[model samples]
Target: MDAKLLEILVCPVCKGLLHLDKARQELICRGDRLAFAIKDGIPVMLESEARELPADEEVGQ
Candidate 1:
């Protein structure tokens, strides 16, 4: 993901900062516990389309 784009992207639900998981191609919102998918270098920021994080998952940089 582009650094410029990642800087501006936030969680749709809580407007919180997102951590870009480049290897997984997902933008993770810890506050909302959601993972927004990034497909073909484009982030899919829709809340309805976000996937819920697994309860056992640990999120952060």
Candidate 2:
């Protein structure tokens, strides 16, 4: 993921800050409990495309 893009990216649902999970290739929204996937270096920010984060998942900063 591009560093510039990550700085500007936010959760579509909550318009909140996102934490990039490099290992998972996903942008995590703690507030929304969603994970937006990064496919081919592009973030899938659509709510319909986001996956529901497991309740037990740790959203690390």
- Each prediction's total of clashing residue pairs, residues at least 3 apart in sequence or on different chains, is 0, 0
Q: Which 10 consecutive residues of model 2 have the lowest summed lDDT?
A: 52-61
lDDT of 2: 0.92
| Poorly placed runs, candidate 1 (over 4 Å) | none
lDDT of 1: 0.92
TM-scores, all candidates, are: 0.92, 0.93
Q: After superposition, how far is residue 28 of candidate 2 from its true place, in Å?
A: 0.4
* lDDT, residue 48, model 2: 99
Q: Taking the tens digit of each residue's C-alpha lDDT, what string does model 1 give over 1-61?
A: 8999899988889999999887789999998899999998999999999999989988867
lDDT of each model, Cα atoms only? Answer: 0.92, 0.92
